[model samples]
Target: MSLSRTLTRRQTLLAGLASGVMLARPRIASAAPTEFVMGVNGGAAYRNLYNNVLRHFEARHNAKVVPVFGSGSELLNRVLAERSRPTMDCFVTFQGAWLVGKAEGVLEKVDYNKIPHIDDVHDFLKDPDGYAPFVNFGAWGIVYNKDTVRTPPRSFKALWDRAYDRKVMLGGVYHWQIHLAAFAYAWTGDQKNIDVAFDKVKELAPRLAGLYGLSSDTQSKFQQGIADIAPWYSYTAQRVRQLGVPVAFQMPEEGGFLYPSAYHAVKGTQKVELVEKLIGTFYDPELQPGLAREDGFIPSNKKTVLPAAVAAELPTMEEVQRCHHWDWALINRDEGAWLNRWNAEVRRLVRG
Candidate 1:
């Protein structure tokens, strides 16, 4: 419980207060279908959210799901900014962002019994605290242009090589978690020591091509040959290649971090049971593996059985162990300062 980071974001809340007041209605008088907005990551993965997850839930519940998509960080800002009355009933976003939302007091816990399929989740991925229900995961590592570099990057450390000068696209300010994990792993062998990580970032500053905030932006950079490499997630790498970009992913020998995708209810949302149930739809054993085949991420459900082709392609969870797993509470406490340091010391030095 760090002091709430969202208390000062009242300006954003004020701006939306009038609209929320006008639209916030009691579901008392009717049995009409409920309409709720879901905030999620934008870009290629929208396919899985729509085709595999959303539509089915909507059909069964007679509800209308409107999706508001953005990068995980952007969605986090929205959750905190609208703390008193969130416009999005629930957000399907990343673990670190969810940690911040929970700390900021904008997130609501799901009653485990309410989400039926939650029991199907692997014990290792379940959140004992109940705020973030991580449904999918992917490997975060280096992705390189296969056409230009015949030698696939074998280590995260390769990003700093002089040969990659002005040819690397790193995550933007919003993606502070990955940038920290990357630089720390590159220099200090783990993500816990920020002092060492900051030093590594300053050293790599000279070689950066630019910073990107979205999957679409990353794909365009690789496709147009604007950058030949980036520290990115495997699911994003797979989506980029599917769009005709020639790239390949590798979990460096030191290991890569896990990108866990989670969904949590907004504190003031009127549709509590509905929101949790919708999230539960993603856990259906038959639908969970589609996260692997279609969205390019590993499923979190213990009962999910991936097809042979997908099983062969994805890296084993064991491959992601070199770095220390991130702890949610500590991350919430330190994330803001990390972003501030990145902007002041690292972002200012790099040129696109």
Candidate 2:
């Protein structure tokens, strides 16, 4: 061939080869999976612990977690409000509110096949309905500052003691229902029948320093010595103590209340499989112990072996066994009515 024609043909062949290589190259994979939204209880301790787990989960699955923190009731409200166009993928709530959420049909049934680690959860903590699975548990009891209170009160009745007048604090409406039930159980031997409990709370209202709505507020009250004694969760008490507060937790002789907090996949989440995997992480035996230690929560996974310090600070198994676990289903059935009564009658009686 002529030299010019040969050169043209060679250039054409090279251009065609380059075009073919470019066409064969794969497009960069679409962006990583969208972040999952989780609604969780609000508190510095809880936020820190959840963030740690989320970071680990994100790294492993190439997914991100966006945590939405609020009180259990507030989170439940958010889930219900957004039900038609669900924004949150998963929810973590205390038992009372979890039951309410379940009753409201805002949660999806847990698919055990997708979350195999759930098989390792303690049978007692499992949800019979398979909707919400318990992740951790904590006890509710009297929390007092050792330096301020010369003698620690030993029973729920102590709130009514004349000495504690205007020196006690109680959690707000929904949260304090557990305390009210405790008094009813102590006074009538029945948590479900709280008529007497209402009267008891009314009597003690005059003595209460105030009704605190946020955990942070409760903690601040105790830290500032504005409140001397109050009803509080043991896990939270431990967290406060770790902060160098002089707080101490005591289970009233009438018995303490134990509540199991759980995780539920919000119905209509597009990330069902990913949500299941995230829930499974909560039950990972290896991870549960560390989370339990950090948050002062009792791990739900039976295989979790907590470190010595964590175990020592947590309630003994026997103590937990003896603690009263409210029939949240029954409570949920009438929770709204109870809250109405509390707002109308009980809350109005708060001294200030």
Candidate 3:
């Protein structure tokens, strides 16, 4: 399908109301309420964490939490669509989504005084104005079926190798592709250096099995023996293992990109106190540690202790610290141009 046609259809259904939408009116209350809603990534384990740890606070405060599960983008666009109506009280998303939301004026500054745990969080995670605070760090790399490919690809170069032609795959529709493209460019020390990145991809074109639409597609393809390698999030590596799939997740020797998910209060949300309470709950040492253990994300607050097994398996703080960082702000500021150029160049290489 044509790109414009696809976007127009998405816009009509999901692009959300333009900036012209009126602001929502905050609900008034004499004191803290007993009920608040939170939007989070959809998953059973995450839901369990909220029910076991965070809900304890709500019970202590005589309040209740309602969770609306979605991806970061889904939550952001939903909040944006309901800008005038304010359907969500607190929205949890990645740093990129939160920054974009803050820039769009859809988020409200969190009062640091209210969330005492703010003091425990690392400086890099907290926004100056407190509009959104990061919850955890995540890395991007390759996930492959260990049983299928004995000599796994060590780096991005392996994905393009002639030996693996028509056996490689990647999650192309989601943000992993964005991060991979960004990483490819960043590795060249040229954020806008599409030519180099495209050259790399073109070299791998002969090995391309197909582009996938979802993370599950990558996992599924690998399990069915359709793909030999797929680029994915570090967290997914653990989840894939839990599913009884013998998968090997690798961080390229050249280093991979990392991103963080954040929590933000929607502007004019009625339950400000409730939102603050929920955000504060996220930083609770007790909760943060469990989140890290269960979700496979590095905790935002350094105080949270990860399980020994999990810590041993995942990348260390020092290792994460050593990798080069991609400038997410620049990417957010110019994603359209980058994607456009990426598409054109990739198509040129593929068409050849």
Where is model 3 poorest over a 10-residue stretch in terms of lDDT? 21-30
- Residue runs of model 1 more than 4 Å from their true location after superposition: 1-32, 320-324, 327-332, 335-337
Q: Candidate 1 at 132: error in angstroms?
A: 3.7
Candidate 3 lands at a TM-score of 0.80
Best of the candidates, lDDT: 2
Tens digits of lDDT, candidate 2, 1-352: 7777667877989989877776776333334656888887766766556654666677767787788887777888999999899989987788877877877899888677788587778777777787766767888888888999988888888778898888888888447667667778988889877889899999888778887767778888888888889988888887788778888888778778887777678888877777778777777787776676656677777778888877887877777777888867767677678888888988888876
Question: Lowest-lDDT window of 10 residues in candidate 2?
Answer: 25-34
CA error at residue 229 for candidate 2, angstroms:
1.2
Tens-digit per-residue lDDT, 297-336, candidate 3: 6676778787788777576777677555566776687777
The segments of candidate 2 whose C-alpha lies over 4 angstroms from its true place after superposition are: 1-34
lDDT (CA) for every model shown? 0.77, 0.79, 0.69
TM-score of each candidate?
0.82, 0.85, 0.80
By lDDT, highest first, what's the ranking? 2, 1, 3
Clashes of 2: 0
C-alpha lDDT of candidate 2 relative to the true structure: 0.79
